[model samples]
Target: MKKTCVHLMLLVVVFCLTTIVQNRAFSELDEGLGKSLKQDSVDVWEDFLNTLDRRGLSDPHWELESEDKEKLINYFKAKIAASVSEGLTSLPERLPSYVHRFPEGMLQTLKSHAENVLKVNPHNGAAAKFLAVEAFHKVNTQISSEKYPLLEKAMVLAPNDIEICFFAYAACTRLGDQTREEALVALERMLERLRGGDHKVSYLWTVRLYTSEVAATPVQIYLKINKKHPIIDRWEVVLTEILAVFENELLQTPDSGVFNIIAYIYEAVGDIAAAQAVFKNLKPFYEKRLAENPKDRTALTSLANIHNKLGNTDLAHEYSVKVNPTLAWEGQVLPEFSPVVDLDGKPVSLADYRGELVLLDFWATWCGPCIVEMPNVKAVYEKYRDQGFEIIGISLDTDEAALRKFIKENQLPWRQVFDGKRWEGPLAQQYGVRSIPAQFLIDREGRVISVKARGKRLNALVEAEIGDTID
Candidate 1:
C-alpha cells in the first residue's frame, strides 16, 4: 500500500498537454518496445505482463509483485480517469537496479513512449516534449529539439501551438546551440516572438535560424581564422534548389511549416517569385481553412498574411477585426505592423537599393559549398567597382564578431549585413533564403533579372552586354 501510494502520487503530478490522433486513420500500429502496448498496458500489471515477455528489459518497465503491480495500475487508472495527461514523472520508486543494465536501450524505450503514447496518441504535441526533457537527463549528448524529428513533426502538425514551439526552442538550446540547430530552434522561437502580439507563425526552423547560411563560420576563432568565400556557381545551383523547395512544398503540402521556410529561403536568395508563390499558395489554404473555421485564429491570421503579400490593404486590415470563437483553426493573431530587420541592426527599405545592380547573396559559414566561390565574387566586385556592380552580401551568421572578421579576412570590399539572429533575421525572410550560397542578380532598373545566379558568373553575363570582357 505504501509503495502504491508513492507510485500514484508521482503519476498525478507530471503532465504535458496532449491530443489524440485518430488511430483508425493511422492504419496499422507500431509496437516497438511497448510504446503501442494497448491502454490495458498503461496499468502497471498488464504493462508488467508485456514486460515479462522480454524480462531482460523488465528493469525499464516495472518488475513487481502481483499485488503491488495491481495497486500501481489502480493508481494509474485513477490518474488517467481524472485526466489521461498527468504522465508519470518517473517510474515507480525503486525501479529494478538493472535498469542500468541496458542504459542505451532503456533510454530509447522511454523516448518511444514519450513520442508515441504521450504526444501522438492524444495529438497532444505538448505532452510529447516532456519525453524529450526526460531523454535529456538520460544521455550524454545534448539533443537539440529542433533536430529531433518528432519535434519537427509536432511543429508541422500544430504550427499555431505555442507551447510546443516553446518546447522546441528549449530543446534546441539543450542541443548545445550548434549554429544550424540554434538557428532552427531560434527560427521557431523568433516567429512566435515576432507574432506574440498578433499573427500566424512562419514555423520553419533551419532557414531563419540565424547562423547565416550564406557566409562561412571561421575555421579558427580569432584573427588567425582561415577564411574563404563561397563558390558562386554552387550558390546559383543551391538558390534554384531552395526556390524549388519553396515551389514544391507549396504545390504538395501548401501552407506547411517547411513552405514558410522555403519562402524565407527564396527571399534570402532574392528569389522573390518563389517567395511570393509561398504566400500565394498559403493564401488559399488559409482562406479555405478559415472558411471551414473562420473562428480559427491561425487561419484568420494566415489569410491576413496572404492579404499582406498581395498588397491588399483593405482586406489585410479587415482580418484585424477579431471576434473570439471557442475552436480556432490556426495560430493566434495579434495586432499587426511588424517590420522586418536587417542584419546590421537597421530596418530595411526597398527604396534605398534602387537603380543599381543589386546582388543579395545569403550564405552561412558552415556551408562548405557556399564558401568556395567567395574569391570569384571578390574579383567581380573589383572588376566592376567603377562600372555599376553592387553586391550586398547578407551573412546569415548569428555571430556579429565572426561575421565581421569573415568580411575583413576575405576583404569582401562590399557592404555586409546580419543581425546574428539566424533564421529570424528580417532580410532572410524578406528575401526567403532556405539554403546557403543563394544569390539574386538584380539589374540597374530595379527589376529582378534572375532568381538564381552566382556572384562572379553573372558578372560575365552583364559584361557581355558592354560588348567586351571587363579585362
Candidate 2:
C-alpha cells in the first residue's frame, strides 16, 4: 500500500511539471512574436524614410548599383511579408501611400507584394488598385500590356473610389477599347466627385486627365481623321462640361494656368471664338504684371509665346525683342557652334552643313507628333537629297535599342545625334528646344528663316527653299 501511494504521487508531480513547462514555452513564443512584429514595423518605417530621403535628393534608382537596388526591394518585400504574416488588414490601405515614394525599379517587387496581399485576402481592394497603378506605370514605360481587367476588378471591389475610376478611364483610353459613351460615363463620375472640392486639386487632375501629351495626342489624331464622326459630338459635350468647370473655378480664382488651359481646351475642340475670348482675357493680366514690373522676363516671355500662337506677329516680335535683343528669331543668324559627333562616332556639325539649306530637326522617337510627322519628313528627304537640302536629326531618345531600331527600320538617311539623354542633351539645351518636332529652317548662309515650322508648314518651307535646286 505504501509503494502504491508513492508511485501515484510521483506520476501527479510529473504531470504538473510537464504542463508548466509547456505553458512557459508558449509564453516565450508569444513574447517573441510581439517583439518580431514591432521590429518589422520599425524596419519598414525606417526604410520608407530612407526612400523618401533618397528621392528628395533627386537620386534616381537607375543610378544606384544593382546590389543597392536589390537591397531596397528586399526591404519592401520583407515588410510586405511581415504584414501578411501578422494578419494586418490595414496594410493594404497603407501600402499605396508609399508607392510613388519608391522608384520605378521597385515596380516588380511592389506588384509581387500586391499579388501576395491579394492571395491572402482576395477582397483587398486597395491592393488591387495599387496593382493596377503599377500596371499603368509599366505600360507607360513600354514594359507591360493592358491592365484594364485589373482596374475593372478594383473598381468592382471599391465602387466608390473616384480616383480608381479616373485611372480606369485612362487605361481604357490608352488601350483604345472604350467607346464614347463609356468614356463619358467615367468622365462624368470623375467630375461629380470633383465638384465643390479643392479647385486646385480639381484643376490638377483635370490637366492630367485631359491635357497631357499622352492623353491629348490620340484624341487629336482621331478627331483629325474623323471630323464628322459621332464621337466628335460626344467629345463636344464633354468639353463643354470641362469648360464650365474651368470657368467656374476661374470666377472664384483667376489663375494663369487655368486661363491658359481653358483656351487650350477651347482650341482643341475647334471653338475658335471661345479660345480667342480666353486669350483676350489673358492680355489684361499680363499687361497688369508688366505694368507693375516692366522687366519680368517670365511675363514678357509668356506674352511673346501667347501672341505668337495667336498670330499677332508684330506684338510677338516686340515682346521677343524685349526679352532678348539678340534672340534667335527668324531672319536672324543662328548661334554658331563647333563640330559635334554623330551617333556613328563621326564628327558632324551644323557648321559642316553650312552653304546648304539645313533643317535642324529636334525630335524624339517617343514623341507621338514626331512619329506622326516622320513619313512626311522621309518623303521630303528622299525627294530633296540630290539638292543642297540637308536635315540634322537631334534625337532625344533615351532607349538606344528603340532609337536604333526606328532608324534602321525607317532607313533614315540623315545624320542623327543621339546621347541617350532625353531633354538634357547638350545640343537640345543649347538651342532652347523644349518641345519635340521643333524645326529650325536655316538658309544657305545659316540665317534662321523660321524657328518653329512643323507639319505641312515645314513641308511648304522646305519645298520653297529647295524647289529651284530640284529642277
**lDDT by residue for model 2 (183-219), tens:** 5566666676677777776766666665442343323
Number of colliding residue pairs in model 2: 0
Error of 2 at 239 (Å): 2.4
Measured with C-alpha atoms, the lDDT of residue 249 in candidate 1 is: 43
**What TM-score, computed on C-alpha atoms, does each candidate reach?**
0.29, 0.57
Overall local distance difference test of candidate 1: 0.50
lDDT of 1 by residue, 215-245 (tens): 3211111112122423333434434543443
Model 2 compared with the native: what TM-score? 0.57
Candidate maximizing TM-score: 2
